[model samples]
Target: MNTDFQHGAMGPRPPDEDAIMVLLVDDQLMIGEALRRILASQPSIGFHYCSDPNTALKVAAEVRPTVILQDLVMPGVNGLDLVRQYRQSPATRDIPVIVLSTKEEAAVKSEAFAVGANDYLVKLPDRLELIARVRYHSRAYLNQLQRDEAYAALRESQRHLMAANLELQRLTKVDGLTGLSNRRYFDEYLAAEWARAAREGSPIAVMMIDVDEFKRYNDHYGHLAGDEVLKTVAEAIQAHCRQSSDLAARFGGEEFVMVLADATPGRTEELGTGLCRSIERLRVPHLASRVAGHVTISVGGALAVPEADTSPIRLVDAADKALYQSKAAGRNRATMMPEGVA
Candidate 1:
């Protein structure tokens, strides 16, 4: 018997992915030896023999053979049934199987094919013909495995590219200094919210917030300190806009805006006054600020039930006017858009 005919150690052989590996399951030791002699001359082909019909599937899985040569008349189990089991097992399901039988009857060959056998061979087949069939089936199976691996790699690459594109879009909408939504994103969101409010007959509130004497504060404390103050103020505003329907954004340098969907006038005023107190509580010292020793924000809010015919920009203008009133009346207070002010 050739040393290449392996019997007992059913553990997997080292992976030889490009090589043609064959697993033969036959009850007779003589038959295994005969097949071994036939394949041993071809160093490119590897062979494993499992005499126990019950463990054939296990050995096939461990060996990861590209083709299987199964004997038809095993003692305990039917060879056709074993082929069906191979088709059912995930590890060996795609492997090609060639059934060896003594009978050359067409009925027997048809049954073998019905049970998932790839080819049927008469016992002691011509060596040239056997080798040809083995090489043909092994080549086709290996090609399929390569295609599956390539497709999986392509899907993984596409997944990573989509994630990177989403991250890039989010970065564009964010303000670099304050980590709030930028003015462009704020405008887009406000328009959408306004249309929704109009359709639903809900009130929308907008607040224009300005840091007190920001230019003087920036001159007194260095620009870095000014950036820090803006970051802190942005955080305070974000804390107030906790609802999913509320949005806070950096309107421009030293200025911010908040949009509250479905808010009442009283609720809007409450949030505006609360935001002022929240910043004053931070106690970011502003020596140049005439409003307070610590940081304070002036808030001007406007509430409106949006109409389908009117543009949303008018609400923003109204809030800006109210902001001017707050600055004129000792810059620390919150003021509502006066009645009859468009």
Candidate 2:
């Protein structure tokens, strides 16, 4: 067997870069030389040879030949077994295999096809027939490879698009200034939570919060300072809510709202009072206010067990009425709606 292969002598073309490349695996040097001469005339076809049957698969992997010409008889090796091994390998499984034999026999041809040989031909086949079969199988293999690459690219593009859409949806629900849920999202959440509470016979709490004399604060301190104050208050309110079932939102200018699931009236009042004290502790200056020297907040809350027949608006209206009472009563206190009011 010739150890020296003819691929380097024929001038190697990069694997998968060329349209067609042929690997001839035969123990006989004469057979390899004959096939090389036949394919040498075609400038488009690249030719490679491996005389050692043992090294045929390794050579095929390195060459990445589009089509392989395999012989049935080689010393210490069965060509059919080699074809089966080629089919089993991930690297060479998709490459077209054409079995070359000495005589045309029906049993040999049938056995060749049974073991995954694509096409079979007598040794030293007519040049035109050999070239035609190689081109036919190689064209189909290349087309399949291109399609696989295109499909993979499309899936990756879809993955990125879905991630971007999720981020966009999240942005729409958030307030740009306070990083709290916006009023629109708050309303949606309240309605959904109300329905859930009604189903479970659980109590829900709603709180209305207002910065005391905010217009005066904005006028005395520039609008930028007032904005910072609102952000600070929003953070305090969000932090005080604590539970995963609690949600805080910027309802509008100088006002915020919170929803708490499964909260009792006493618990709601306690949280509201704590929030007011937390803001006061910040010691933010409010020179123009009638409340206190430092900034203060007024809170009013309502707790109710939602019923299927009742509207969520009733709860919000009750909370709002309580908020008005807080403003009227010294402007810096927490007030809770009386039982049966909501």
Candidate 3:
């Protein structure tokens, strides 16, 4: 709703002045006919008439007139009162009203002005003045409407632009192969989480996961089949790490990494063991895997409270060293470093 409309011709031109709308509320059919004929020469002006004094307000809402002309005295209602009603209505409040009276009494003119009348003229006004007044009021209303419409369109465009940017950001951080976080995003997110843990005195954890006998699987099953296994294993890892701040990413071929924020060494061990079990449940056959008849993962994890002296790389090295031990002791298992190790 907050919009700054540039009042320039460069903004927008309302559907040509060829469709100006004017409404007349009077109980006289003969007078309506006379006024219609007078305005007919100007095809740009669309004139409508309501002969029923009681139903004039309803017809005005339907017509959405830019300018209204009301007879000062109707059969039962005073035209000044109708002008006040139009001014009070949210829909018709901005419309210009002109009072037309057969008897031009000075007091009546003053009363009409007090009741929201924009202009006062005698019945059957001068042709030049009627056209000029109608055109002026019509142009004023249409200009404002056009400006509002343009600002609305601009706001919609800006909303679409913002959504598109967010989508692009999401796509850039996603890994195309496994629909997991890409390495670039994983590295940045881990660094950020590490810094946050340091400031908050919370423990940050890392898990280095590697597929057992992956190269043998690729060699025996072909690269495409190996790709499918990689995808399945990546999904298994992602499913096990449920924390919103935890990140799972394919570190490289046959290797994946997870960064867990606000996690303890004990919690890290539990999650790493769960990841091994989840992959085992997949039951994907791997004839070349020496550790098992099916595909499996070896996980090495470390957790530490970040200090001003200790760096993120040191914690990563500890996790990497533990992963080396898991692979050496035989794959398809989880290994955790000693807790409180700097």
**Residue 157's C-alpha lDDT in candidate 2?**
75
lDDT of each: 0.86, 0.88, 0.83
For candidate 1, what is the lDDT? Answer: 0.86
Q: What is the TM-score of each candidate against the true structure?
A: 0.57, 0.57, 0.57
How well is each residue in 1-342 modelled by candidate 3, as lDDT tens digits? 111111112212233445577788878778887888788788677777778767777777777777888998877788888999999987678778988999779999999898888889998898889999999988887667667765468667768999999999998998889888988898888778888889899999889999999999999999999999989998888887787888899888889999989897678999989999999988999988888999999999988888765568888888998899899998888999986664
Model 2 lDDT per residue over 248-300, tens place: 99999999999999998788989989989999999999999988999999999
Among all candidates shown, the one with the greatest lDDT: 2
| Minimal lDDT window, size 10, model 2 | 8-17
lDDT of 2 at 191: 95
Candidate 3: Cα lDDT at 239: 86
Each candidate: RMSD: 15.4, 15.7, 14.8
Which residue pairs collide in model 3, if any? none
Instruction: Tell me how candidate 2 scores on lDDT.
Output: 0.88
Off by over 4 Å in 1: 1-147, 338-342
